[model samples]
Target: MRYFLTLYILAIVTLIGVAGFRGDISRKPPIEVFPDMDRQMKLRPQEPNAVFGNERSSQPYVEGTIFRGMPYQDTPINTGRISGTTNWVETNPIELTVERMKRGQQRYNIHCLPCHGASGDGKGITSKYGMVAVANFHDARLVSMTDGEIFNTITHGKNLMGSYGANINIEDRWAVIGYVRALQRSRLATLDEVPEAMKAALEKE
Candidate 1:
């Protein structure tokens, strides 16, 4: 019993010594101490500004420069006749034959009719809800336009129309122009101009 009592007293003294050491260390100042500096003298890296807001302080790029791979330049635009040779060769308008007209009609119906109406009357579904009005190809102004002019308009849209250059290829644009002319002709074609044989063939079909 005396031996066990001595062991307990030693254990109690060791725990008290450990606790006293911990308390002494806790009362002492921390090893790391930070000094408060003046706001102006503080060295802080500035953050990058957002791209959109505060335009006045933003940097501007040079104007009239052309980026590689783009067709257009930022230079002053001169709306004039296109100079130099073009793939658009001048040819007599295709004959208003049924087969040729049918091809044009098919192309127009698929790509154009939804926005320009089946009659080319500019009453297409998109036009009805669209902010800008679509042109009526049947109008005298458009009907009198040359085939090349019509083709250009289709390739690079005029006024409020967006360009179809990407959507429809050059050949298809010409075909659609031919079809527009055919539609105009159909609206104004006289009875005398309609051949007797064509009338008979159409009736049989």
Candidate 2:
């Protein structure tokens, strides 16, 4: 019985030593086992590189390269697709009479008034947000501008304003220009020179 007891104690001690060496023992003080644990903690920001995949390669304008393997289509103003010197349409083909002026007014009110103001005074709701200042359509410099010049400005956009070619069709843009001319005329017209019909119409209202 004594011999058997001695052998059992020896086996238990050997097993415990093996477990401690292999880190299998639990509930031991961590400080005593790993004194350098404080030096092992670290944090790092992730790199900006995207993962490699078919989807990443398919995106357009990725890393400044156009994807989809298609040629870039240049917009009108961006690449001067339309000649700058050439007239957009015939000049002085027909006078901008009252009827054309009325149509132009309607188109301008629908599209331009929100940013250019009903009076072309550069005051619009969007202007309050610090966006590019809209030019006063009634400025003397603008008043002297040719109809074709005005059309080009509207189509190609000047300065901070983007081109309206995509939004307003060519014909409508021309009509708006005619309307702007009429507005300028009205602002500068002498009271005595007002058309009799227009004078009467104003009094009736």
Writing each residue's lDDT as its tens digit, candidate 1 over 1-205 gives 9999999999999977656645475664444434343224432334345543643334455696577666542211111124343433343244455675677778789888878899999888887676447888889997777676676666678888767767776556666777887778889986668789788766676
Q: Write the per-residue lDDT of candidate 2 for residues 57-169, one digit (tens) a residue.
A: 23334476666647335433322233444533324224567776687789899888888888888787778888556888788888777666676677778887778877876
Among all windows of 10 consecutive residues in model 1, the one with the lowest summed lDDT is: 72-81
Q: Model 2 TM-score?
A: 0.49
List of clashing residue pairs for candidate 1 = none
Candidate 2: RMSD to truth: 17.8
Candidate 2: deviation at residue 12, Å? Answer: 50
- State candidate 1's TM-score: 0.49
Question: What alpha-carbon RMSD in Å does predicted model 1 have with respect to the real structure?
Answer: 20.0
